[model samples]
Target: MNYSIGDFSAITGISIYTLRYYEKESLIIPARKENGRRSYAESDIAWIQFIKRLKDTGMPIREIQKYAKLRAQGVTTMADRMEMLARHRAVLKEEIGKLEEHLSNLDDKITYYRTEIRKCTNLREDRRTAEVSCCT
Candidate 1:
C-alpha cells in the first residue's frame, strides 16, 4: 500500500523536510503521484527505519549514503555492503567499550558520594542532639 507524505511522516516519525532532504541526499526515493506529491510505499517505511537506526548508530552521512547506494545496487553488492557493516560494527564495539568504562567510573563516584553522605548523617545528628542537651 502507498501512503501520502503526511501519513508517511507520522508513521516514520521523520519530519517532511527531513524526508525531502533524504531524497535530495539520494538516501530514499519515494514514488511521485500524478500531481507531483510523494507516495511512499510500505517498503519505504522499512527503509526509513533502517536509515534511522544507521543515524542513531552515529554513522556518518557519507557512510550511510554509501550504504544506500550499495543497497540500490541489488544483491550483487551484498558482500561489499557486509564489509562496510562489519567495519561499522567494529567501531561501534570500541565505542561501547569506552562508554561502559565511563559508566563504571560514574557509578563508582556515585557510590563514594553516597557513602560519604551516610557517614556525615551521624555527625549531623550528634551536633543537633548535643546542642539542645535536653536538661530537665
Candidate 2:
C-alpha cells in the first residue's frame, strides 16, 4: 500500500526532515502523488531500513550514495555491491579485535588489583595477631 510522507516517516521511525534530507542526498526517491506530495510504497520501507543499517554500520554518506547508485543500475552491479559490503565487514572485524584486546587488558588489571588488596589484608591480619600474642 502507498503511504504519504508523514505516514512513511512514522512507520519507518525516521523523522520527516531526515526523509527529506535522504531525498536530497539521492538515498531515496519517493514517488509523487498527483498533488505533488511524496508517496512511499512498501518497497521503500525495505529500502529505507537497509539504508539505515548501512548508516549504523559506519558507512559514509558518499559510500552509501555510491552503493545506492549501483543499486539503481540493476542486477549487473551485484558484484560491486558485494565487494563494498565485504570491505566494510573486514573493517568491522578489525575493530572488534581491538575492542576485545582492550577488554582483556582491563580484566587483567582488575585481577591484579584484587590480588594486591588480598595480600595487604592478609599482612594486616598477621601483624594484629603478633601484637596480641606479645601483649598476652
What are the RMSDs of all candidates, in order? Answer: 4.8, 5.5
For model 2, residues 25-77, the per-residue Cα lDDT tens digits are 99999999899999999999999999999999888999999999999999999
What TM-score, over all chains together, does every model reach?
0.91, 0.82
Which candidate tops lDDT? 2
Q: Kindly report which residue stretches of model 1 are placed more than 4 angstroms away from their true locations once superposed.
A: 129-136
Tell me the deviation in Å of residue 45 in model 2. Answer: 1.3
What does candidate 2 score in Cα RMSD to the true structure? 5.5
Candidate 2: worst 10 consecutive residues by lDDT? 127-136
Candidate 2 yields a Cα-based lDDT of 0.92
| lDDT of each residue in 1-136, candidate 1, tens digit only | 9999899999999999999999999999989999999999999989999998989999998999999999999999999999999999999999999999999999999998888776666666877654332321
Q: In terms of TM-score, how similar is model 1 to the real structure?
A: 0.91
